[model samples]
Target chain A: MAETRTRGRAPTDPPASFVWTRRIVLTLLAVFTLVPVYAMVSSSLKPLEDVQGKFRWIPSEPTIRPYIDMWSTVPLARYFVNSVIVAGGATLASVVIAIGAAYAVSRYRFAGRRVFTVTVLSTQMFPGILFLLPLFLIFVNVGNATGLALYGSRGALILTYLTFSLPFSIWMLAGYFESIPRELDEAARVDGCGPVGALLRVIVPASLPGIVAVTVYAFMTAWGEVLFASVMTNDQTRTLAIGLQGYSTQHEVYWNQVMAASLVVSIPVVAGFLLLQRFLVAGLTAGSVK
Target chain B: MTSAKVSAAGAARAEGAAAAHGAGPGGSTGGRRRRRLPGKALPYLLLAPAVAAELIVHVVPIAVGIWMSFKELTLFYIREWSKAPGKGLGNYRVAVDVDGAIGADLLRSFLVTLAVTVLAVGLSWLLGTTAAVLMQERFRGRGPLRAIFLVPYALPVYTAVMTWAFMFQRDNGMVNHVLADQLHVTGGDRPFWLIGNNSFWALVTVIVWRSWPFAFLVLMAGLQNISRDLYEASALDGAGVWRQIRHITLPALRPINQVLVLVLFLWTFNDFNTPFVLFGKAAPAGGDLISVHIYHASFVTWNFGTGSAMSVLLLLFLLLVTAAYLLVTSRRRPAHG
Candidate 1:
């Protein structure tokens, strides 16, 4: 398309006269997109007084006092730890299991293959909220019945989050595996490698990008999720997602602290997205649809 | 490098073995290797974890929820070393038909969720699709501009909602201040946005603003996939921009738009964070969405039975809506099979 458009026309698609207008629009759009994030970061650095309604674009006197105050007043460090443990555990477990399952589905011509694939896709349709109470009840029962006390434990949060992450992991990884040529695995087998060896030595290495994408997605979804975290854990085992809920008291909510904490929590997610964004975007769009 | 040397030695050994075996093959016993059956239970072995976890975490809850809907139980009763005594249709009755407190709250919760979902999904779709199409045009600095558009999505919900709370503050909020200063408007002398029905609207606005970027991203990706030739051909045929979009772009975008709208509708309906942070206990009074109501029921009121029942009903509602969506969109396909 670009070649044809440039066949008889100038290099620039639009008239040269509109360049300045485009720049103005782009600047405005950039500012509009950035203002909230700027406010969040600046507000995190400001003292309570400077965060008031009359606050300007840049702080008159920047301070990290809010961060210090939040650290002292709240369980920020603990929430961070809890979030990391749950997200990391869930990601590792989901990705490993998803890789095996995805490889099996993509490469093997087993009976019930179509049914298995459809079941995986259909699980995405179930209402996530509906499972909350029943899950809570099950945890409560298991805690009591098994004497392990899953309720309000970090283990419970991890287990619950696994449910949400597994379906997508399987779906995306399956697509990624299917995109690889089966001949690679066949060639490995002819070189004295068995199916399992071929999978580990050849298939897994080939699908590293997809695995990274799934890992990042699982981590973000688990870390950022609130529902199961809120229901499954209490203050002690609470994740950052749940800990953010504390900004609200019975009567009033503390917006500054919440904003500060939210910004802190989002740092990893945004950084991860930006760093592996190329692979993540490629994997997601390629895997999600036909 | 180490593996290559090892393989070279191994290859020499294999060559000797092959020549030696060829001469001695007449004396060897013959055996045949059977083709490995595809359904050798290996697939199930690999699938065990995801399938088991889904069953335990997802499917079991659904099954247990269905059972709980037909029974009566409470935290107090459960702690007393007792079973959830069977009460056929009683929990459902209380959840759906009662007049006093639970039913009224449940009904109001459903209405709030519906309103928020419709407003959020509808408004975001409109804004996002427009932004996507407009932003698709070649323009300078467009790359940075596109990145900027994703800030709202990248910001954590807790912070966004908290910022919304500050912005909606009665006296000193930026939103109210701007309205009073620039627009010469006020909800009152000291407007408490979260105190009245205005709270609902304010929450919806924040949600729509934060969520449109998601829709926008999807639409932009979808739009970018469109073949430029289709648009160019339409333009060459003298169709107006709107006509070209209607005739060419819309048809190609229908599947993506349908899936997105449905998914967004479900998500917004179940969203609990904004309402919880913005209003706190005042959520039920101001109008709690179903998710908030379920949270309050289970945690605050400690009514597990009612909460489970509410959850089951909400799920049923979602299923019905999803079914309706499937029906409509399925029928929307071109008539011929």
Candidate 2:
């Protein structure tokens, strides 16, 4: 990887045309990437009439009215709270569960260990949509049979999100655990630490980056999920993704508020990504890249 | 590395020998002591929660979904879907039979899905490879440029799709404003991007924009693994940039690209958010991908059985594709362990 850095110019200057062409292409791609984001932010600041009327690159009369109205106009704040609860809960649960399984898979040899690894990988093969209908049916049936209403609940959404997030989390964290030398765990065990204790004190601290990566992955999965959220959530428990749909209905579209709320919903995840991008990239390309 | 491998192999043999000796009556005291403890069950204990959750949430539901497809489960029998009368391929016939109501739509949706996945994945792979290769060259502002390129992938799906939806508005969209008013590309006839035939292109544009960044990221990482000496060696042989990329870069990146394309194909085929958020309950005729089509059939029309059948067919198709993909890639790397 370090060699790739020196592969380009051989410590010599390239021609002026090559440099200019590179800069121009980079600038063009940057503009292409940033335009929609610019439009989103600028349009969010604009008044309703301006959003529906002319095409302005910058808002002539910029105001935070949309942001102010977003909370009062709909259940935007409620949805944000719901998203926080669901994503936070799911992230915590997924990381904890994946940590244990990943440790076992990475450290100890056991029966069906190969099968366990294969199962984790196979879960990624199935599309989430394939499970929707059956899961919905099961939830409804279980509710009716046992008087436990799982449908339209945050718990249900969290569980469904686990289906989407846990496989990748386990895969990534297991890889991270593998990279940590087994000597550390043995050393910890020799010093009066048991299997669980060594994992907590030594392995967990050493694998903080991987743990952070898994947490972000799980959080982002729960946060941005829409297909299941839309089906499984109701008015009181709607997530941010489902709640954003409130802006567009059969009657009227609230473009300004939608844009404002989109930004609000996106800030935490995007900030998380920017901060932990290295770990996130590592997690995403865990097995496939090598 | 060789020493590490040798030691690992020795450790495995030692463990196997210990287990084999423990089975006999005259085992070593250390082996007996190790077996006396319940530590052997620790791995299974730790794995229980994940396995349980996956089985309950994913596996069982999938089994139930497959069963549901054979029954006449609709809104009327949804509550008692367990007891719904078995239709014995009746639902499958309805889904695949061209003369039936939903059969034609199902076929059309499959075609649209195929086209969308092929185009979106192909274009994204092309754009991503080009951008990644370009970024490989040492240049000014490359760090920030790379980060900027990742914005589309980093943004939440709903936010990105909503922004595109806003941009794709028919009358007052920025797309029309730019093309019709500013650039005069369309000659005062603003195309309706959100509806009718053009929605396919609009949806494709949004998907391509969102997905290319992932391909770029993967390819960039893959590029890092390629020995730069190869490029220098090729360059020394008077090979042009294109030839070097074709021979050295593409072959080196083939493994990553294989996985990338398959994942992209599956994702784009099953993508529900873009079309759903952009078009609402029913996508335009031109843009009705199978995911949304199944979604509407089950949810909007309250035909669970038919939806399950369609989804089951989709699952089988994806399974075949994934198996074939793994087969091809796994064959290439027989040393994978």
Candidate 3:
């Protein structure tokens, strides 16, 4: 990679003072990035009096009470479970659906191929707000007409999420698939493998990193989504984003517990990104480079 | 069992290829054989489910939104929206006329959104590009610094914004405690960061913090794609770092910067999460972003027609901006290519 090459040569190195400047700047930037996060964690541990009293860099008497209380506070567990189910289901469904289309677009040359690709890219341009009213109306009308009970359900949120996620998944997967050489599929064919076999056995395995990136992207979108989830979900099906709103109201706000719940909600995604940083970076930058 | 069926199908395709080759001349036979393949429809079959889903969820809804913008959609008629009375251009007039109540509010929110998008994108791009370029040198703790830098982007949006919300609290918030009490930057009384006129800057601060990491990542990737040889040659020719960046690095990263700026602009412009989480359904006067503005109009006030009209105006404006951007970028590409 160019990064490695540049690092090896050290062509951009400056004087010792400049090095110190860079270190100081990077440190300052890192601190700027971390301060809010620190506040969140420290405040979560602090008692209400300490939080409202003098501000301390570190809590004087740290406790896990907020974390413990967060569970019983406001349906935190239910929101977490609901987020997992909706995000998980949306990710799986979108990935499954996108794989076939991405593979086809990457491997085949057919009529309307360019149009299909352009259509996929164009979907990203439309703002999400434009879709909310119409989709809500459609759901209401469909439920009333067909007795499907689609409104106020997790199914509605999952479906609504696909409006954004499906296009992105398809685009990312197609870029990944394109990077896998066509010769591999030819080799599979010569070994008595059909098109489906070539895709399933060769292409999918070769593109696992890309696939993982797409899955993570879809999951994150569904997980952190607030707009449609707030509108479409009722109390029983509320996702974590909507659930977090319960901590604050017109009258009062729970600062300590909100921080605790926020920390708990952020763990999976941050850990996931740290674990899969390489693949995610590669998959994200693939399309732009080409 | 699946492998057996797949192998059987492969065998039949092989035979078909062979037969077509035998029946036609050499040069054109490959095309003929491909055209005659029994799986010619497979690509379309594979594409159907995704295309169908997009059409139903995205395309159909957008069409419906446009149609609904012209109708009198309110809480009373929401149960059967199709039967709502059509208002033709009445909603559009109400949305855009600057003299009226709804129109004036929409216009104000639109200006606020414009300012927010411009400032947020500009500052984030500056910070991100500088950090990315600075980190290109061989430095100690670069790996750890990179990871630390990405935390803002990697962390969940709601979590990050929620933390910012807590920190911006007037009484117990760390921001005021540090600025006013500790540093003596202001008086002992904490300024209200989440409400009134101050909310705009507060909103901008949180957004810039959350979004700059994305710009950092993209610029970093673009920097990686640039060959080190160009910088080395420029150095040998006695050019300084600033000159090298101006003549080589900037030009090399032009394409990336274009797309990155556009994406960030769109996301920031249409953003609902930051404003929604920070301020509620009805944003403070100072921070009435268009998304929340429209949401308040439609959802809170239950005037779907006016809200849809405002949204349609936003959609058209964004589409125009995007088209203009793409055109200008495409025109410049050939020179670089």
TM-score of chain A considered alone, across all candidate predictions: 0.87, 0.92, 0.92
Clashing pairs in 1: none
Q: Chain B TM-score of model 1, please? A: 0.82
Please give the TM-score for the first chain of candidate 3.
Answer: 0.92
What clash count goes with each model? Answer: 0, 0, 0
lDDT of each residue in A126-216, candidate 3, tens digit only = 6778888888889989999999989889887877665456766676677788788777887888899988898999999998887887777
Q: Model 2, A1-290: lDDT tens per residue?
A: 11234444443333455456566766777887899999889999998887878667888799999999888777888999999999898889889999999899777766787677666556555666678899998888899999997999999888777656776677677767877876787778889899899899999999999899778767877788788888998899998888888878626677889999998888888778767767756654454432
At residue A8, give the lDDT of candidate 1. 28
lDDT tens digits, residues B1-337, model 1?
1111111212222222233434554212224432343447778888888788878887778888777766666766554324778777777788888576778878887887788779888988887776776566754445566666766765556656677777777765666666766566764455668778787788788777777777777777677677777767766677655566578877877766766787677667777766766676448454477788788887787766777778878877877987898679858876421
How well does each candidate reproduce the native contacts, as fnat?
A: 0.31, 0.44, 0.46
Give candidates' CA RMSD values in order: 10.8, 6.8, 7.7
- lDDT tens string, model 1, A1-290? 12124442122344443444445554555565666676677777766676554545566788777776776556889988998999898878878888888878666656675566555455555555667777777777777888887899877777777656666666667667767776688788889887778879998898898788778767776776766776788878888776766665524444556667778788887777566655655654564343
Q: What tens-digit string does per-residue lDDT give for candidate 2 at B100-174? A: 778989999999999988999999998889888777776556777788898887787889999999998877789
Q: Between the candidate structures 1 and 2, which one is better when assessed by DockQ?
A: 2
